[model samples]
Target chain A: MFNLIRRDFIIQKRQLVMYVLLILFFVLLGRQDPAFIFLLASIIIPVNTIAYDEKPETNILMNSLPYTRNEIIASRFLGTIVFIILATGVTSVLMYVFNRPFTTTDIAISSSLALFLLSLYLPMSYIIKPGYSAPTALISFLVLAGIVPPIVSYLGERLTSVTDFLLNLPVPIFYTSALLLGIVFYGTSWGVTTFIYRRKAF
Target chain B: MENVVEFNNVTKRFKDFSVKNIDLQIQRGFVHGFIGANGAGKSTTIKMMMNLLQPDAGEVKVFGMDYKTHEKAIKERIGFVYDANVFFENLNLKDIKRIVAPAYKHWDNTLFTQYVEQFELPLNKSIKNFSKGMQMKASLAIALSHHAELIIMDEPTAGLDPIFRRELLGVLQELMLDGNRTIFFSTHITTDLNRIADYIAFINRGQLVFNDSIHDITENYALVKGRTEFLDRDTEKAFVHINRLSTGFEALTENVSSVKRTFGDSVVVEHATLEDIMFHLKGGLQHV
Candidate 1:
């Protein structure tokens, strides 16, 4: 699994420089709303790296290796965490350098959304051809971004008792439960992708 | 001899074509040549062995272990080269080696470096810049570097010049001197296999037409050329595959003794080449 992740890095070595520049540029431009930059920073590199694997030869080369299909899927899931951490670090440092006013809530919301987006799209990339998968992933992201908040607000307004009960909980407990849910969702996505990949023929 | 690879009633189906009930056993310590025309399931069969393609039915076993259950263990001991290069074309040789070498437990850096030097591959240049033959050499270098017991190649000789093709055969010959490693490669070029292959497995139209020792094929089949008038209607039916020409006709026949006895000095008989066998067996319109 580590070797697979290391391969992704080596293949993207040329794009690594560009990744850093793009992260810094987005953070500085969206200083007022750091979540947009944070989301973009976390997801761009992993998604782009996934796109590189669209070629049939890469699949043949990978299957020819000794790694199990589960390990390959595990690597992608683990690599997403790696990407999330790196993106967060770069974004936090740039925010500090620019004296941006961003709270912990900003980081949590954006990172969780980024993770959710990744968990959704990674399986799609494996199940479908990469050419269709990449554009579909982006389109799905746009649709989610457009619809999710309004739906959440509408539910909050309609179910005041449920929303109030949740808002009244202790901050730590609420955050911990959200984090647990995110982890479960990510783990489930990993298993699902592995299952799909194991059955797929190159 | 123990078998290195076996396909028992293996089947794969697509909308238009399918490989049905292929039963092949590749014994250890020999060079096996897989020959076929275009779209003859050579690549499909190889893919199933490598577990790149799933067999709809039956099983593929490598090193006596089921491929699906022991893919990692079996693949570690097997090296493969595709007809077209399978590496990232944008990456240089060094980068590819770094990515791939760690996947195999028995990878030998010194051996890989030697091949790199022998093949005259540039470490820093991207593979996209290399010629087709150079790319093939690079693929062979990687396949050979892992000390793998079984090497499976798909048309490794195509696109290569005659000089390199001969050189590659020499390298395969040297690998066989150990008398343990098994080589399986598919090719349209019969001359490449004529020199080194011990067994030949011929597939045509997704069916296994012939699988035998090169010696047996050479011993059993003969090319018979004679005047068109010499081939009576009854005699023409004896040929495995016959080709007609304006003045004379050539045919491949297993009953060479009978043909020789009947035609006598009117016909010329010679040992059949692999190309002659493949061409005649393909059974198409006349070729000039």
Candidate 2:
């Protein structure tokens, strides 16, 4: 399973230099939040690797390996976590080097959001064509990010009863429940992707 | 002898095409050639064997274990080569070796190196830069080095020159010489199978036409050519596939004795090749 992860690195060797350059470029913009850089770096490699698998031949190559479809999906999920950790660690070191201000809260939020985003997108990528999935995910993420919060706040302003009920809840409970929901969603996405992949005809 | 692979009532359906009730058996220790035209169910069937595709009904078994239930175990012992390139094209041979070598428990680096040297494949050059033949040789090298008991190849020789195809077939024959390893090779090129395949399984329009020993198939089917006048209504019925030419009528038939009885000295009867058998099996719109 780690070999599957290693394969992604081998295939992405040429892109590693560009990724490093991006990290340096992001570092030069020292005022920019380190968490944002970490998030971007984490997603870039994995998303591109997934996009490269849009070719049916890559599916064939992966399926031809001795690993089960479940193992393959597990590797992808595990690889994402590893990438998130590495990206965060590297970015944290760079952030300290550049004297950029960031807290553990930023790391926690950025990493969790990356996982949540991946959980939402990776299954869609598996279900749909990679070429379509990557662009669709990006556009959808941008559109939702730009629109969802304002719409929610506007609805909250319009409906006091609904806003009051939500604002009354304890902060810790809300955070814990949201964390649990994210974990459940991520686990379910992994299961769904495995099921879809197992039945997929090469 | 134990059967290495078996498909019992396996069926796969697509929106427009389907392969149904495909029953096949491949015994151990022989070169089994799967012959079909393009778009036939040969690849589909092979995919099912590899568990790359799920069957709509029935089951596929490898090494007496269900393919789906024991996929890892089955795949570990089976080396597969696709008709098209399957490796990451941007990665070089060394990179591929690094990725693929660990997947198999019995992967032999010495054997892999020997094949790389034998095939004269450059280590550092990317697979995308290699020619089609070189790509196939690389695939074969990987497949062979794993010490896999069964080697499954789909159209592995489609792009190679005659010399390379022969050499590839020779390698397969050598693999089976020990009577412990087996090969399941799919191809549209029948002549390659004629030289090396012990058993021939022919599929057409998503159906198994015949699965028999090459010798038995050749013995059973014959090609007959005769003057047009000799192809009477009764004699025409005997031809499995018949073509009306300007000079004469040539037909293929399994009822060779009856055809001989009917035409006697008027027709020429000859043994059929795998290509001829496949041509005749299509039933119409194919000549020679």
Candidate 3:
């Protein structure tokens, strides 16, 4: 399974530079946005990586290998985790080198958000056909980004006191809750993707 | 006696066509030629035996183990090359060696390299840049280098030119020197099968017509061409398959010696080649 992941990684090694450049450009544009590079690494990279795989019909070749389907899926999931860890380390060094303003809280929040979002995205990408998946995922991201402002504005006035109470909670509780949510969502998505893989004919 | 590969009443359903209760067996040593028309479920059956596709109703066993439960065990001994190149198109032969070498415990990089040189495949060039024959040669090289006991190839002879085909057939003849090794394969070219295959498994319309030794299929069945009404009804029944034409009825029969005994010297009984036997068994054509 690790070998399979290594194969995917090596095949996509040429595209890694493009990803880094995209992140750097976005970071320059959205300097006000903390965790920009982490977002690019986690959410952007995993989905498009999967998209690249589907384009060449690599699944059939993967199927012909000795590995089982579940092993293949597990390898992808674990590979993403490995990539996230390595990318976060690299992005952290870059931010420090450039003297960018990013605290531990900001890193935790961004990484957790990317994890939650990408975890949900994976099962969708696997279950839906690739042609429809990319457009649909992009549209969903756009719609959510579009709606966030008004929802935050509306909730701010209506629940000012409640928001204050929740915001005043201990930092450890927040981190622990975020960690639990990431684990649960990722586990659920993994299960669903495994089901989809087993039922897939090709 | 354990066959290298066996499909015991396995059935699989596709969108448009279905394989119904396919029972196939290929023992060690001899090459088994799986012959069928296009979409006759030849590849489907092979895939089922390899456990690449699951059977809807029955079981498949490779090397005496249930394929699903012991797939790793089964795959360990079988080298498979499909009709298409199943490796990354942009990857080179060296990349393939790197990717696949770790999958098998007994992988021999030395032999693999030897094959690379022998087939004259460039080590560093992407497989996408290789010609069709070169790609097939690379596939064969990779399949053979693993020291597998059985090789299951689907249309391995399809796109090769006649000279290359003859070379491959000669290689297969040499591979059979290992008395314990076997090959079960499928191809549309009857001449290729005639050159090397010792056993023949014929399939038509998703049903297997018969499975037997090449000698048995050739010697037992005689192509009989004569007047339509000259033969009795039982003689017609004895034919494996017969098609009646405007001038006469064409037929193939298993009762060659018996028919000669019954008909005296008037009836014509001609020895059949593998092609003619397959043609008659599939459906004997009408005589002009």
Candidate 4:
């Protein structure tokens, strides 16, 4: 299973340098939100790895190996978490080196959002066709980014009581709840992917 | 167990195609050639053997263990090469090795290096840049490095030049020298099988036509040519399929002894090549 996860790094070794530059590019631009930059950083590697894995040949190769279908799915889910942390660490250092002002809350929000988006994206990748999953993920991400803020704000304006209650909660508790919610979604997605992949004939 | 892989009453159905009621046992320490025409469930049967596809109705066992409980254990002892390039095409062979080697408990770096050298495979070039033969050689190198007891290849020599095909067969023949490794490879190339295969499992229209030793295949199947009138209703039953030529009637018969007994001096009986059997039987059991 670890070898399966490690496969992403070996496959993307050349792209690693480009990933670092991508984060640096966003940081130096000094225009996007630090949280958004962090989220982008966290999402890139794992998602790119999925794009590599979405190929039929890759699935055939992996399934033919000594790894079980469950283990293969497990590796992707766990590898996502691992890459999220590594990406966060690298993004934080870049922010610091560039003298950009960012808080730990930014990291918290970005990582949680990254987890949420990936939770939805991972299983969908399995459900979608091989050559199209990566594009579907990108479009879905863009659509969500465009619509989510307006929807949330509209709800915030309309549902005053619920908004008031959520707003009244302590900041730490709110962030913690969001992080816990991300974990739950991720775990569920993991199970769903394993189930889908098990029945799949490669 | 004497059989390294067994499929008992196994059946898999696609929307328009199916492999039905296949009961095959691949014995240990011999090369078993799986031959079928295109889209004749050759890849489907191979996929089922590798556990890439599960039978809808029956059980598939490898090395005396069911895939449900022993997928990893079963796969550990088996090596597979698909018809297409299954490795990451962008990565060089060395990186591919790094990814694949740790997946096996018995991966021998020296053996892999030796195969790389023997096959003249470039470790630094990306797999996409390799020729078809090189890609096959690379797949073969990885499949052999782990000392797997069963090596399953799907059309391993499909696109190679004749010389490379012969070389690949020679390598497979060399691997058989240990008398401990079993190979089950699916190929429509019957000539390849004639050189190295000990047992031949022929599938036609999703049915197991026969699973017999090479000796049995040669002894049982023959192509007989005689005058057209000689192939009447009673004698016609002896042939799997009969081709009525202008000059005479040529047919494939599984019952070679019956052909000799019935025809006597009237007909000429010749050894049926694998290609001849496949060609005739491809018409789907036309006894008449």
TM-score of 4: 0.98
Give a tens-digit lDDT track for model 3, residues A54-173. Answer: 642467666655667788788878877777777777677667766676787767866787777778788888778767777887898788767865998899879999778768888789
Candidate 2 ranges with C-alpha deviation above 4 Å:
A148-177, B286-288
Question: DockQ of all candidates, in order?
Answer: 0.87, 0.84, 0.50, 0.90
> Each prediction's Cα lDDT score?
0.89, 0.86, 0.78, 0.92
Q: Which scores higher on TM-score, 2 or 3?
A: 2
Q: Considering only N, C-alpha and C atoms within 3 Å, which residue pairs clash in candidate 1?
A: none
Can you write out model 2's per-residue Cα lDDT over B151-218, one digit (the tens) per residue? 99989999899999989988887888889898998999888888888899988989998899987887
**Backbone clashes in each candidate structure, one number apiece?**
0, 0, 0, 0
Q: Which 10-residue window in model 4 chain A sums to the lowest lDDT?
A: A175-184
Candidate 3, residue B63: how far the Cα is off, in Å:
1.0
Per-residue lDDT tens digits for candidate 1, residues A155-184, read: 999999999999999999998988999999
Candidate 2 lDDT score at position B130: 94
Docking class of 4: high
TM-score of chain A of 2: 0.84
Could you give the CAPRI-style class of model 3? medium
Candidate that would win on lDDT: 4
Q: After superposition, how far is residue B92 of candidate 1 from its true place, in Å?
A: 1.0
Candidate 3 collision pairs: none
lDDT for B195 (candidate 3) = 77
Better of 3 and 4 by TM-score: 4
